[model samples]
Target chain A: MRLAIMGAGAVGASVAELASAYGHEVTAIADSNSAAIDPNGLDTEAALATKRASGTVGDDSPESVLEAEYDVLVEATPTTLGDAEPGYSHTVSALERDRHVVLANKGPIAERYDEVRAHERNSEGRVSFDATVGGAIPVLTTIDDIGRSNVTAVRGVLNGTANFILSRMAAESLDYEHVLAEAQDLGVAEADPTFDVDGTDAALKCVILANVLFGGGYALSDAAVEGIREIPGAALQLAAEDGQTIRLIGEVVDEEIRVGPRLVPETGTLAVSGTQNIVQLQTERAGRLNISGRGAGGDETATAVLGDINRLL
Target chain B: MSERTDVRAHTVRLELDDEPGELLNALGPIAEHGGNLLSIFHERGNRTPRGRIPVEVDVEATPERFDRIVDALRQTGVNVVQAGAERYSEELTVLLIGHLIETDFSDTLSRFERCSSASVAEVSLTVADDATDASSARIRLAAHAGETDRALDTIREVATEKDITVISPLTGGDAV
Candidate 1:
């Protein structure tokens, strides 16, 4: 398949690197500033090397990347709330042009799922966003296997930054501020970590999952979101003494979506440590299916993006 | 016609009140929901504690159709005790030693039975003289191919909560 990749960040770069080996073409790639497009497939290695040397993917604007001819549009842009920006417009443009879309970006789908679906309905292209929620954990594809109607609930540790902090805090018996500082030093948390630590990231993922399982129109604001900043170290120790550990769990049942730190049995599946993500799908007939893997990282997210492209094939 | 590739064999156990049309009424949902009946085992002499007759049914249908069949059975007021695969290829025996009755042994068994990946094939209980004394149970569990470890982990979690000790073979297990 020919692909036009938006967002030349880690995910897009990794997708460009891996797409050809998987028998797919990366015809175009764009960063926030610039883009590179070629009708007969861009030189992925040269494009990536250029992006590393200079901070932009190429000279073409994001709009130009969307205008390029490709069978699938790989959206890997960073997520932003409200309008969900160039990503949303880019998706609408690609779909209107009768091209399928594979999203690694969560903004357009989470904030404006109904609008995206509306565009997909009229367009010849379909949309798949496996990397939006659980990175490379195959959460959405697993949902596809059993059918969405059979899923009763979706619970997971969606954000790696928050999970890393909480797991470290619980293990080292450190306070939130100390752990947050440590995470920042380790590049786990962003310099401005409000979106991750405040539960918005997890909430966004949960809202997207709720829309997928129960249909569209669920926004990040619809979820009951809470962060782990207020969870004291004493509470973690107390829970540990009781053979339980606290994890930042995001759960969606029916239309209700919530993200908060909950006590899970230490030996249980949800008590995953460090920067790992786990998604457990409770089905009406298939029982509980648990899948865990690296929730973040450029290459991992790109693997999911490529998997979605292959699924379209 | 070519055979459907997605079709799977499913078994459903039902408890029906002893009535003239109860047996016929119970089979209606299976047929109505696109299930092709393979066999039926109706125990006429044996009755459940509720005085309902126990019946076991084998049918072939796709997963979606099987879900519909189960729903139809419930809607028609048939007691569907179990509706899934009959044979779990992998088997393991675990022994739980503790206050079995106090920790709710029945609940433990129910949890193991509820897991779709595994099935509680058989259980044997050994009770001490007094109710206050500790007791033990040897549970034989069967799981779908390659799901025995997951099944064991679930049992371990339940055992940990009930303050029971679990003992099982680490290796030398095969599919039943």
Candidate 2:
């Protein structure tokens, strides 16, 4: 498959780097300001090096990459809320040309599912967003394998930054601020860290899961979210005394999406620690299924995008 | 025969005056109502705020007989704290984080008990050394079977009113 990637962020760059290994060609790649396009094939290493040294990928406008010839357009851009901007428009442009879209961006699919599906219904292109929900955890694909109707509920620790803080607080008896600062220093959490810690990141993932499980009509605003910011170290101590621990859990059950700090057994499957993620699917026939792994990072997320492209083939 | 088939386990919590014959007096109503005695957990040392001993009596009886047993106990002036069959078969544990001491923790527990569908079974509070800092409490609630959602909703409401953050147990999954 010839892939055109939008947004030269970590995930996008990693996708471009790993595309050839997965038997795919990078026809075009674009960052916010510049574009590197080649109808035949672009040098992945050269483009990435240019992005590293100079602040741009190439001299071409970012808009030109959308028009480049490609079999799959990987939307690996930064996630935005509400309008889900440039990403949504870029997705529509690809779908308008009947090009398949593999999304690493949660914005378009999380905020605008029905509209994207409506476009897909008219066009021959299909959309796959396995990378959006749980990085490389294959949460959406697992739901697909189990059959959407057969899966009753989906819950997990979808965000790494929140989980890191909570687990560190429990293990070392540290406060939220201390663990969060440590996480930022270790590069496990971003500098701002608002979205990941405030439950918005996990809520967006849950909203995306709700949209998948219930077949659209759910958005970020529809979710009831509470962050782990207010949880003091005393809470973790109380939980640990009872043989349980606190985790930032996102749940999509019975058409309701909720993300908040939840209690799970200390040794339970959902109690994954230190930036790890776990998704549990309640299947009607198969009982319960748990899938856990590194739920973020550029290379891990790029694998999901590549997997989606392989599926398109 | 049908009544025998319908018999189920029911628990009744009672506050009896710490006096001689109080245990025998509580047992009299169950025998009179055709309720077979399953067990009796008489906590002689544990007393309620009113200075009465707490007793947990388990009985096996039909729904009709259970209702009559409860009524007979109440009519006999026996203080029945809680009574139902399968009403609290499920337990939910949640962590409450915030100024628990400042917000009157006892009042919060009483409000939960007042819901009727749930009862505060156990609580462990951890207070910070700094008096004004936030405290945390682990509360175990016994809720009616299939009514965990209602119990959670009630908890959320009370917590919201008191400006507390609730870390609820993940439900609908056996792993947690």
Candidate 3:
């Protein structure tokens, strides 16, 4: 398969670098401002090196990649809410051309599922976004194998940044601000950590899961979200006294999406520490299934994007 | 008479006024209702917030007899903290964080207890070193089976009115 990756960030760059190892050719690659395109297959290393040195992927305009020849379009753009612009438009452009779309961006699917599905219904292309939810955890694929109807509920610690701060606060008896600063210093959290700390990131993942589980019509506004910012160190201490810990949990159950700080048993499945992520699925016949792994990273998330591309094969 | 006559064990928690022959008076209802007394765990030293002794009585009775025994104990003025396995069978633990002292923590607890589907079972509160700082309380609630959602809804409503944050347990899963 020939791939055209949007967004020259970590995930997209990793996908471009690893495409050949997976027996795929990179026909085009685009950052926000520039693009590198070759119908036969472009030099992946040179494009990445140019991006590092000159802050541009190539001399070509970013819009040109959308018109380039490619079998799969990988949307690895930064996630945005409300309109879910560039990502949604990029997805539509691929489906419009009947080319498959593999998404690492959660904005399009989380905010506009029905519209995307509607577009796919009219095209010969198919959409796969295994990277949207739990990064490399294969949450959606597991649901697909189990049959979405048979999966009754999905819940887990979906955000790694929130999990890191909460776990550190519990372990060292530190407050939220102190641990969050440490996380930022460790590069586990971004300097502007509002998205992860405010629970919007996890809620977006839950919204996508809800869309897959219930077939559509769910968005960020529909979710009931509460972040871990207001949780004091005393709260973790009080919970620990009772053999429990506090984690930012996202749940998709009873046809509703909810993300908040929940009290889970300290040793329970959902209490994953550090930057780890876990997803627990309640099935109708086979009981509960748990899948845990590194929820975010360049290679980890790119592996998920590549997995979707493999399925497109 | 073709009803559920098979004997089953049931546990009932009761609060009794510390008085002479109070235990004897409480046991009279079980025997009168045709329930076989299994055992009595009478905690004489520990007293409830209402200054009443807590007693846990296990009885073997038919489903019909168990219901009658519970009703009889209640009608006879025995404070039935919890009765039968099905009633208040679900236990939910949540952390309430905020200015608990300034917000009247006692009133918050009373509001939870006033809800018909649930009752407060245990609470552990911790205040920060600075008196005016935010405090946290771990409240354990025993709710009627399948009423866990309603119990949580009541807590959320009260928390919202008091400007408190509730870290609820993950419900409808094994975490509960």
lDDT of 2 by residue, B1-176 (tens): 23323455578999999889988998998999899887788998888999999998877677899999999999999999998744578889999988888898877775665543466667888887887778998988877678788888888899999998888887665564
Q: Identify the runs in model 2 with alpha carbons over 4 angstroms from their true place.
A: B1-89, B143-148
lDDT by residue for model 3 (A40-102), tens: 999999999999999999999988999999999999999999989899999999999999999
Taking the tens digit of each residue's C-alpha lDDT, what string does model 1 give over A1-313? 9999998888988999999888999899988888899999899898888888997777888788888889999998889899998789989999999999999989999999999999999999999999998898999889989899999888888999988988998899976889999999999999999999889999999988989988887998899876877565655665565455677888887578878776566677887889999988888897788899999999999999999999899
Consecutive 10-residue window with the lowest summed lDDT within model 2 chain B? B1-10
The order by descending DockQ is 2, 3, 1
Off by over 4 Å in 3: B1-89, B130-133, B144-146
RMSD of each: 17.2, 9.8, 10.3
Instruction: Rate residue A22 of model 1 by lDDT.
Output: 83
Fraction of native Cα-Cα interface contacts (under 8 Å, chains A and B) also present in model 1: 0.00
Best by lDDT: 3
Per-residue alpha-carbon lDDT of candidate 1 for residues B13-123, written as tens digits (9 for 90 to 100): 999999999989999989998987877989999999999999988776778999999999999999999888655678766656668788877677766644434656666
**Residue B82 accuracy (lDDT) in model 1:** 87
